[model samples]
Target: MENENKIKLFLVDDDALFLKSLEIEFMENADFTIETFATGELCIAQLSNNPDIIILDYQLDGIDQTAMNGIETLDKIKAFNPNIPVVMLSSQDKIEVAVNCMHHKAFDYVVKSETAFMRLQKIISAIFEYRKMKKELNWYMDRM
Candidate 1:
């Protein structure tokens, strides 16, 4: 059996080009094993406990055989496992969307543009840091 330290990542987006490009970039430069889906429903189907982090596009196509969006998808994920880190991506720098995602416990939000390349690295680092802190906290709690 593999340990929890593998650090898998899943990306749910509708953009085909970005999906291909991101897979290439991460495979070339990052330590994470990446799985991607073109729609939220597809992502949900491929879901596993191994993915420590998820990147959610703010808008998604069909889910549940109905129109589904990222906010709703985020809610579904929270219901599944609130501890898994979710990073929201938006086409525009919408503060309201950011606030809503943060309220629902999204790890971070990144604008889907020039800033995306930069934010991806930062968010991945933050997720690893958060996991480390959480492990330390759990260890302390266990000993107490």
Candidate 2:
């Protein structure tokens, strides 16, 4: 598939192994322009590239002691472009963390586990489908 036609994804995580694994899975399974970032700061810096979806890690301080956590990154991404879908990924299974991410306008939250890749795929599909529906509805509304 052409690069323009493929979905663009930003995968942000401090864990090198997990990040590589996720990247490989997406590359093997889907037509996606995938970019991996070891830090939220790098992801934020590339917001202008306009990724269709971002899977960000909740704890980004694994390498850097003072790096912005997932919530902060989510907020920044939202501030830059509220329409970009961001899925928060974390090892933490705490409800509060997920709730906090949702409260900050995250598209969704996925706990980092064996099923994370599958869950992310589903969520990404849903995001695109929802956007398509919204656009169609707007088009119909405009005709009326």
Candidate 3:
């Protein structure tokens, strides 16, 4: 049974199996509330509703996103909510692409595989820490 109070997650991926599998895995393993889409466009549409985290695939169908790939999507997502944590996911292991995605503000870029679930857990933990730190820093800055 899925817990009613699990952290919300919005996952974006073109592969249906990947999206569905990850959703189930996260739900079963981490007690997370998940909403998944097979395309970036759909995921982007739902992002305005304020999901706690976004797992975005580097590629999407029907969206000529290769030139910018996931970076363009990241820009748009950040524009709407800069503080919302986003983790980029891709089958490719190219460092340049990963670097570019990070430069564009992805919390982390993860390579998809059998260990993807563990990586995601680490990402969630890291993002949680990052947000906590940001809040602390913000509080300090306000006092200063």
What overall lDDT goes with each candidate model?
0.80, 0.94, 0.83
Candidate 2 lDDT for residue 57: 95
Name the top lDDT candidate.
2
lDDT of 1 by residue, 1-144 (tens): 354445688988887887788777777877767889877777777666457889998877633345568888788888888888899988868899899889988989988886686788888897788788989999999999
Candidate RMSDs in order: 2.7, 1.0, 3.2
Local accuracy of candidate 2 as per-residue lDDT tens digits, 110-137: 9999999999999989999999999999
- The pairs that clash in candidate 1 are none
lDDT of 2: 0.94
Error of 1 at 45 (Å): 1.5
lDDT tens digits, residues 1-144, model 3?
454567889988877888889988887788677788776667778886678999998876533434334667788899999988899998989999799889989999999999998999998998888788989999999999
